[model samples]
Target: MRTLTGREAVREALTEEMKRDEKVFLLGEDIGVYGGAFGVTAGMIDEFGEKRVRDTPISEAAIAGAAVGASLVGMRPVAEMMFMDFITIASDQIMNQGAKIHYMFGGQLNAPFVLRMPAGAAEAGAQHTQSLEALLYHIPGLKVVMPSTPYDLKGLLKTAIRDDNPVMFIEHKKGYGEKGEVPEEEYTIPFGKADIKREGKDVTIIATSHMVYKALNAAEELEKKGVDAEVLDPRTLVPLDMESIVKSVSKTGKVVIVHEAHRRGGIGGDIAARISDSDAFYYLEKPIKRVTGPNTPVPFSPVLESEFIPNEEKIIEAVLKITD
Candidate 1:
């Protein structure tokens, strides 16, 4: 096993996939020689050449559209948006064209592309920082993935590239440098599976992406307070692993959902709803709690941004609210 940053794991996944399948190619801004906005694609252009690792113009719409078109003709194109917020510019292509083509064309055509976006707040201001997985999760045809660890990042990205439908791969910018153990052998984590980062009996904390790390930290603090907390990561949101969620809730009887996205219309709310709707409702000892970002744009000030993002303190508070 080797310890690697989330960035390195993703780069390795992309490199392995490109070499394993000729149909797999990358297209994005500053991805070729510049090695992507976050340097996830560093050295790929030199290894694969410009035709496979392309640097596109500053147009999200064109980038997404080209990916959709390429996928229609049997190419697996992984397109990257410099920022998750800019994905709005390419919504039409992703939501309407790529998402609909498979169903609308009687299964004759499918868009097997992956749209990679670096998301979450890093004091990057409102324009660049947003946990917008909720937007893509709402769309019926897209598969949304938000991996927290370097191992999961590599495995999920490999799975996303091989799937026959469109995938929205979200990388939390704040977690890009985080290191975790990753194996040298090839592996892929299936979609719709939950990874329990920690096991507990008092409460269950369901979180995504960067928030998973915060939840784990909160679990540690809870342990010190004699409150055992289980932290679970959905890994992929669209095809959510509700069975695992319900099972955790059944065992713990208390659950708290955490995310950096706004509390309004966030995926946390939806998870809470599903739990309430399922048999897990009877297992609840108290109302489901959520520790989420406020219903406001991300702030530019570091202090304000810190308050805006959900952290270990917030997660612990939410857990205590129900457990006590």
Candidate 2:
């Protein structure tokens, strides 16, 4: 076993995939010599060359559109948006064209492409920071994935590249430097599966992306207070692992959902709704609680930005509110 940062894991996945499949290629702004906005693609250009690791103009729409076109022609393209906020500019190409082509063409054609988006607030202002996976989850034909750890980042990226559909691979901006243990052998985590980061009996904390780490930290604090908390990570959003969620909720009786997205219309609300609708509802001892970002734009100031993102204290409070 070896340890790697989230950025290194992503770069390794892309590098291995490109070498494994001739059709796989990458295209994005500053991804070549610049190595991407966060340097996740550093040193990739020299290893893969210009044709495989391309640097495009500063146009999100063009990048997504080009990926769609390439995928239609039997190529697997991975397009990167410098920031998840800019994904709005490419909505038409992604939501309308790439996501619908396979269904529109009677399944004869499919866009097997992966769009990598670095999301979440990291002292970046409203214009640059946003957890917009909820918007992508609304699209009918697209698959949304938000991985928290370096290990999951590598495994899921490989799976997304091989899948015969459009996948929105969302990465948290603050997680790039986070380190985790990753094996040297090749591995791929299946879609629609949940990873139980920590097991407990008193309460369950279901979280996504960066919030998963916060939830685990919260769990540790809860244990100090004699409140055992189970942490579950739904690695992928679209094909959610409802079975795992239900099982966890059924055992713990109390559950708290956490996400970096806004409290209103966030994935946390959707997960809560789904739990209420499932058989897990009868097992609930109290109402489901959510620890999420407020319904406001991300602030520019470091102090305000830190307050905007959900953290360990908020998660612990949410768990205690329901468990107590």
Candidate 3:
């Protein structure tokens, strides 16, 4: 295995898939020559050229409209929105058009495209950093994936590009430069699969995207305090691996759900409800706790932004309370 940054892992997957299939192409603002706002697609335009590695206008709606049309005509277009907040500009095309095509047309058509949204709060202000994963995951026909590590990002992104329905592939802005091990050979990670980062007995910590890393750190700290914690990553929200989550809760008897997204209407509520309603309901010793972002717009101040995002301390506090 070789190590690669999350940006490199994503670029490698896109480059390999583009070379493998002629129909696969990249399109978005600053994605071609600028290499994406986060440099995830750096040096990609040279190999794929302008035709495939297109630099679209600043209009998110136009980018999504073109992607939907391309997918309808048998092209797998991967479009990126520099920030997830801009998703509102393209919501019509994504929700009304791409999402409904397969079901609206009696299964006679499919919009097999990928919308790459770079999300999560930083100093990028309120507009550039909204975790809209749960918002889009609520759509009936869309597939939502959030990969935290380079290895998982590379594999799951390749799978999204090859799938037959529209997919929302979210990349955490903070994770772009983070490095991790990825195999030299090609591999694809399946959806609805939860990866248990650590095994424990006192409590289960279910986290999404970058929060998985935070939860892992919290688990380590909890261990020193004599409270064992299990960390689980639900890779995809729509096809979430409730089986793995339920099993972990059944064993640990206590749970904490963490995410960078705001608490109101986010997937965290759904996960807690599901466990309380499942066969594993009786396994619970305490109510499931959620360490999530406050239900407010992202702050612009560096200090406030840092406090806005969920961190290891929050996870540890929640676990300690539940374990107590």
* Per-candidate local distance difference test: 0.95, 0.94, 0.92
lDDT over C-alpha atoms for residue 136 of model 3:
92
Quote each prediction's TM-score. Answer: 0.99, 0.99, 0.99
In angstroms, give how far residue 74 of model 1 lies from its true place: 1.4
Deviation from native of the Cα of residue 104 in model 1, angstroms = 1.8
> What's the CA RMSD of model 2 in angstroms?
0.7
lDDT per residue for candidate 3 within 1-324, as digits (tens), equals 689999899999999999999999999999988999999888999998999999998998999999999999989999999898888999999999999999999999999999998999868888989998888988999999999999999999999999999999999988888899999997899988989988999999999999988998998899999999999998898788999999999999999999999999889998999999897789999988999999999999999998999999989999988897
- lDDT for model 1 comes to 0.95
Report the C-alpha lDDT of model 2 over 1-324, residue by residue, as the tens digit: 789999999999999999999899999999999999999999999999999999999999999999999999989999999999988999999999999998988998999999999999988799899999999998989999999999999999999999999999999988899999999999999999999999999999999998889999989989999999999999999899999999999999998999999999999899999999999999999999988899999999999999999999888888888877
Model 1 TM-score on a 0 to 1 scale = 0.99
Q: lDDT of model 2 at residue 117?
A: 96
Stretches of candidate 2 exceeding 4 Å from the true structure: none
How far residue 43's Cα lies from its native spot in candidate 2, in Å, is 0.6
User: Residue 43 of candidate 1: its Cα lDDT?
Assistant: 95
Tens digits of lDDT, candidate 1, 1-324: 779999999999999999999999999999999999899999999999999999999999999999999998879999999999999999999898888888888988889999999999997899999989999999889999999999999999999999999999999997789999999998999999999999999999999999999999889999999999999999999899999999999999998999899999999999999999999999999999999999999999999999999999988888898988
